[model samples]
Target: MRLPLGLAAYRALSWRAAQPAQEPSAPRPEGALLWLHATSAERLAALADLGQRLCAQRQGVNLLLTVNAAVAPTEPAALHTASGRVGPVLALTSDHPGLIRDFLNHWRPDICLWTGGDLMPNLICMAAEQGTEMILADVNAASLPRRRGGWLSDVTGPCLMRFDAILTDTAETATHLRRLGLPGRRIAAMGRLSTGASPPPCPDTALNAATQLLAARPLWLAALLDHDEIAPVLAAHRDALRFQHRLLLVAVPADADDTANLIATARDNGLRSADWHGGDPIGEETQILICDDSGDLGLWYRMAPLTFIGGSLRPTARGNTPYEATALGSALLYGPHVADHAAAYARLAEAGAARCVRDTASLAAAVIQLSAPDHAAAMALAGWETVTESAALTDHLIEMIQDRLDQREAAAHARA
Candidate 1:
C-alpha cells in the first residue's frame, strides 16, 4: 500500500533534517542574518544598500548577506563592494546545499530573510533549528500553477510554525498562510519593502523648475512606458485636451528607443514635444516632455497631482511600481496587467485613491474625467491618506523583531 501523503511528507522532512549540517572552516561572530533571494544582481545590490542603512540606524547589529551565485558576476560584484562597506557578504552557488549550509553555519545570523523566491525546505529547517527569526518580504508568487501545487509546504508551513514571525506582502498571502496552519498572531501583513525605500533628496533647483513648468496647468504623469503604450497614451493626452488647453503630460520611457517613438507619436497627435535628454527647458508650447533619465521617477511623481503607471497597458510588461507615485502624494491610474504590483495597487484602488483602465479609450475617458480640478485634488488627498495609513506595518515588523530578540536573550540567561 502507498504511504499516506502527510506521513510521506513528514518522513521526507525528517530525513532532510537528519543530514549533517554543512561545516565551514572558521567561526564568525553572531550577527543579524539576511538572505537575499534577489531576482537580479541589481536588486540584490539595492537591498544590500538598504541593509547598510538599517544597520547604521541601529548600532551593535551586524548584517551578513547570502546571495545567489547564479546572479551575473558584475551584479554580484557590485553587491560585494556595497556589502564590504557595511558588513560581510557570502555568495552561494544555486542548488548547492553544502555551500549554503556551510555559510549558514559560519555566519550564525540572528534573523534570516528570504526575499526573491519560495523558501526551500532544507534552508527553513536549518534556520528553525538555529532559533533564527525568518521573514519573507516583497515576495511575488502569482503564477497560478505554483499556487495550486502548494510547493511552499515543506518550508513555509513548518518553518512558519517554528519562526518568531512571518511578514508577508499581502492580505491574501497572510490568509493563505493561516489556512496552512500558521497562527494569525504570528502573521502580519506588511506591504512591499520598495514602499519603505528612501526617496533621494530632491534638489531645490529641479523642484523649482518642475513646479514652475507645471504652473497651474492640469499636469499628469505617464511613467515607465512600454512600446505599445505610446499610441494609447497619446489618445489619452488628446482626450484631456478637450477639457483643458494647458494640460501637460510627462512621458517617462522604459527604454531609450521608446522615448523617440513617444515623441514622434505625440507630434503626429498634434502636440509639440521636447526631450529632457539634452537638459532643454520645457518651452511654453510643449505639451509632452519626454523624460529619459533613470531614477527620476520619484521626482516626477511628486511633481504631478495625478499619475498613470505605465507598463500595465501592455500585456507583456509586468507593471511598474505604483507605490512610488502613492508615496509621493500622486493619485494613480493603471491597466489590467499589474500582476507584479497587484496588492499595492489593489489596496489603493479599494481606498478610492486609484482607478484601473482596460484599454486606450477607457484610459482616455478616465483621464478626461479625473482632470477636473476638484476631482483630481480629492483623489490626490485620498492617495496620500492611504499611504500614511499603511505606514504602521513597518513599525509593527520592527517591534516584533525586537520582542523576539528580547525573548532569545531571556532564554539564554535562564539557561546560564
Candidate 2:
C-alpha cells in the first residue's frame, strides 16, 4: 500500500522547497495540516472563520494552519476556537519554507487542506504519499493565457491532477480543469467558498444610524475605489447629483490616505462631501460620506439599496467581491475587468440582479435608473434569488467533508 516512488520523491522535494534558512530544532505534533495563502484581509478572515467552524463540529481533530508572514506576521495567534476543545489555532509563517517543512515533519496531519493561490504540486504529492487526504478548497483555475506558457504549463496539470478532491467556485472552472486533463470525478463544483449566506454582523447602533441617515436619499456605495478612477467616479457622482439632489455617495477608498484625495476630488467637482473618520454623526445635508476605515464594508453594503463595486472602473484594478454586497441585499453595478469573479457576476447580471457599466457615464446612468423605487426593489429581489440559489451547493460541500471524515473513522475502526 506504499505510495509510488515518484510520489514519495515529489513530497520530499516539496518539503525541502518550503524549508526556511534556519531550521527549527523543536519537535512538532501530528494532526491535520491546513495550508492557506489568503491574498486579502477579507480572505484571511474567512479562513479563520472556517477553522473555527471545523474545530467546533469535530472534536479531537488537531489543526495546524500556515499563513504567509506578510499576511499574519505573528505566529501562534489565537483563532476563534469553536467549542474550546480543538486546541488553539497555531499560526505559522511561510517566510521560512524550512520552518514549514519542520512543522509538517513534526505534525503529520491526517488531512491537508490548501486554500488560496500558490499551489505547491509537490506538497499535494507529499500529502498523498503520506496517506493524508488532500482537499483544495476555494481553488481557482488560472486564466487561459497564464496556463498556456512557461513553468505553469508543465507543473500545473500534473500537480492539479494529484489532488484527492478539488473544489472550485464555478462550473466554468471545473470545465477548464477537465480541459487541462484533470479527471471529472476528482473535480467538484463547490461554488465559491467565500460566498456565504450572511454578512458579518455589525453593531445595531451603527446600523440604525446608517439607516436613519439614508432615509429618502438616493444612496449609492462606490466601494474599493482606486486613485486613478477617482476623476471618473467624481464625474459620475456629479451626473447623479443633477437628477437626485439628495444623492448620497459612500466611497470606500482603496488606500486609507486616499480618502483625503477622494473627498477633495468630490469637492473639486462641485459636490458637497463629509468624512466619517472620527465616527461623527452624518449630517442631513452631507452629500457624500467618505468611509476611511477598514472592515466595515459589510455594514455599508447593508445600508445601501444600490452599490457600484469599485476597482473595476480603471484598467489597473480587476475587481473586488460583489457577492458580499449581493448577499447584503444590494443591487450590484460593476465595470469591466471582473474576470476573477466573472462567472458569478455574469449569472447575476443575466438574471437582472446586477449591471455591468462600461464607463463612468454608464455607471451614472445605471445608478439613476436602478434608483427608482420599483426598479430597485426588483433588482434586490433578483439579487437575493441569485445568492440563495447557491445554498444547496454550500450544504453539499459541508456534507461531503463530514462524510469523508466519518468514512475515515469507520475504516480505522474496522482495521482495529
- Top candidate when judged by TM-score against the true structure: 1
Model 1 lDDT, full chain set: 0.67
Candidate 2: 10-residue stretch with minimal lDDT = 74-83
- Residue 243 miss distance in model 2 (angstroms): 1.5
Error of 2 at 110 (Å): 5.9
Tens digits of lDDT, candidate 1, 198-305: 454577788887787667667788988888988998888887777777888888888877777887898889888878766766766778888886567867887888
TM-score per candidate: 0.62, 0.59
lDDT of 1 at 81: 51
- Candidate 2 stretches greater than 4 Å from native: 1-29, 32-56, 59-198, 279-284, 403-407, 410-416
RMSD of 1: 7.9
